[model samples]
Target chain A: MAPRSIFLLSSSRVHGYEFLEHAKEHLKEFLSKRKVKTVLFIPYAQSDYNKYTELVENTLKPWGYKVEGIHAKSNPIQAVLQAEALFVGGGNTFVLLKALYDANLIPIIRERVLQKGIPYIGSSAGTNVATLSIHTTNDMPVTFPPSFEALRLVPFNINPHYLDPDATTCHKGETRDERINEFIEYHKKQVLGLREGTALLVEGDIATLIGDRNAKLFLPNKEQAEFAPNSDMSFLLNKT
Target chain B: MAPRSIFLLSSSRVHGYEFLEHAKEHLKEFLSKRKVKTVLFIPYAQSDYNKYTELVENTLKPWGYKVEGIHAKSNPIQAVLQAEALFVGGGNTFVLLKALYDANLIPIIRERVLQKGIPYIGSSAGTNVATLSIHTTNDMPVTFPPSFEALRLVPFNINPHYLDPDATTCHKGETRDERINEFIEYHKKQVLGLREGTALLVEGDIATLIGDRNAKLFLPNKEQAEFAPNSDMSFLLNKT
Candidate 1:
């Protein structure tokens, strides 16, 4: 079996979705060679079926990919097992988790996508769950009331909406860097502070950053550094 | 047995020692009229045990209340069963949850404190845990990755460090009200948007807002209301 690919898109605010267009092209090319039809999963949109399905169908259909929204009430487990590709859209992380949990689709999705080698692409909450845990998500727990347990797709944490320090302003509140630093200090976990427009492309044990410039790497007890995109997806894959 | 009176503080910015002072007063008041002398529980100051223990003891000793800060090596279940009151201080919710999980203290604390009716007081992470869940905490999960499961001391969710909408702000980002509104839209859970110096006093399933004027009450599908600190506590308690 070809190694499954996982893409974690930063939140949509920073052109995260725009980069998805390029990603879709690559995905289409990969799937075409395999003679497989791409299948998109929108677990977060299950609550508002019509709206979410329309959004997913509208976005993926244009790329010549077949997309279907799986509502939890209707054989969600079967949907996961049969899908060739899963694309979880960004929304409220808590709401997404609740739907996943309610539908009992968490384990099924994990089994099929993570262990079964189905390609997975997630933005925002979708990306948030693609980590060992969803503790570092920028979205307030209020948006989706998290259970903290995620899909464990990656070993390290994902700091989506990774913002650089603003030097011109003296914002007394904790900066994004400070917050990630605090997480590193306590948890001692490696984190990928992905700026918007950045995506981590993972194929089996190889994980690489695509789009934008270098992303900030955060490791416990080590100084954070910005490294060029495409340096090594291996760091992410090896950790898992 | 007399119903144990518990005070759940909603403030997060207080220094450890400063908090210890207020805790000592409350403990003294509780113990002065009771036969209890010792209080066993976790502290928010995990890294610096000696310093935290000193601060805890300094205040408790003066009031003749024995205070023991459980160590990483200590069995939290054993400590909870023996303690008269459980004091959970404010800190990162994720860090606290990790410690609680590592120590296997959550079930024990819930059993002893909630089921057994041992007096409990929490602030910040402590306060967050006192609610039905910790899903609404404003603290970045990076600093304190949360599981969102809490002690359910109250039926409602809590947004500690709750700031009123500042009309003067020019920043395009969502305000605190807007964030809570987003949360209400998704979860439809009752949230007590607590300001600094505010406390939620719970007595026998009754929760009253104490301190600060006009704390905001966010209800699902209802208009937000400004509740005076001295307003009837039953209004909140009855919602459950």
Candidate 2:
């Protein structure tokens, strides 16, 4: 089954922006279109679950989002099943994946979101989990997960908060491009380098690039192409 | 047994320096003092193992040490057992760890170097494999390993190529300091941030920080401290 609605944001907050402020209107529109009443915020990525949940709830409260953290629930899997919509906030991807595994909620979440077409919104680490694997994440492996396998709602993985390589810098660390190329070298998955303030909204088979920045599609051993904002990236939903 | 003699370098070359050129004199002095004749080079971190091996060999050739790649040996364990010294070069830590696990050479190498006191030298990703775990690495997880567990040669892990947080940079990505802190938030192990042109020379139980730049030590929930060059970092070898 294709993903009904999956909004993958590059970050929760862009430069000079409030926490997920730019995404609030799009998020409300998305949820409204789907008639979503209840939104479950997965605060798995953050170290402080309470703080994360409170902040998220407060941020979306003005937009009329009945936001509640899954961490506050009794049975996480059941929470996912009951959630009208899901919003996963960003932090460390490894810790987030580990939390999913620890709660044994991967199967249920996949069923609830992918199969049932429950609207899912993710940013940063959250966006990483909606993809094929968390291998392309820029976050440190502060914790180990059961596996790098994600929901696989989309065929390709996302490299969020993507920054272009600094030409003048002599930093020894591999740039986003080099890291993604290396991933492509070993893995067959194409990676979407989604810059800040950008997102990919996947509805069934179509995935569209949102925000002002051009999304870079990194194909293995192939030249990367940039798609302008609001462009039809639906082709990404298809397996290459 | 604790690591008898382990020289872990942050990188093979600092900016403006030749391959391992900065540490060449130190390497010669280390090998000469130990009276080591044969050094087995582990080029697993690099994709092109042949080139990595030859480059390392040529770099150390002037010092009159026999540097050979372990990949060329029929029985790697036997080669490790007979080796007077071991050198692991840098590239990708994930690839290096994966190779170590694939070859099942972890135990043998541990036995030879950590237990038998065979001198070992590793730069960048190679140095990461000598720590308690590779959880603090700055490299990409291009490949998955059986576990992040390393040789446990040192009490704590080392964050190689540690860069000072640039105050002027507008980059949204987490700084090296932030990454190390995040690692400590979830993990109990301390992290030694070894900067470029820096090396940690461990003999018996004494580990000394060698380089001109000040190395940062990150302890969980504790303020990070900068250790001046050539400071006695032997306390790091002792488990807290």
Fnat of all models, as shown? 0.35, 0.43
lDDT of 2 by residue, A1-240 (tens): 645899999998887778888777788898899988779999998889999999988887888878888989998888888999999889888889999989988888888877889999999999999998899988877887878898787888899999899888766666778888878878867889999989999888888898888989898764798899999998887777
TM-score of 2: 0.97
Docking tier of model 1: it is: incorrect
lDDT of each: 0.68, 0.87
Q: Which DockQ values do the candidates obtain, in the order shown?
A: 0.22, 0.63
The estimated TM-scores of all candidates read 0.73, 0.97
TM-score of chain A in every predicted structure: 0.87, 0.97
Q: Which one is best on TM-score?
A: 2
Interface RMSD of 2: 1.3
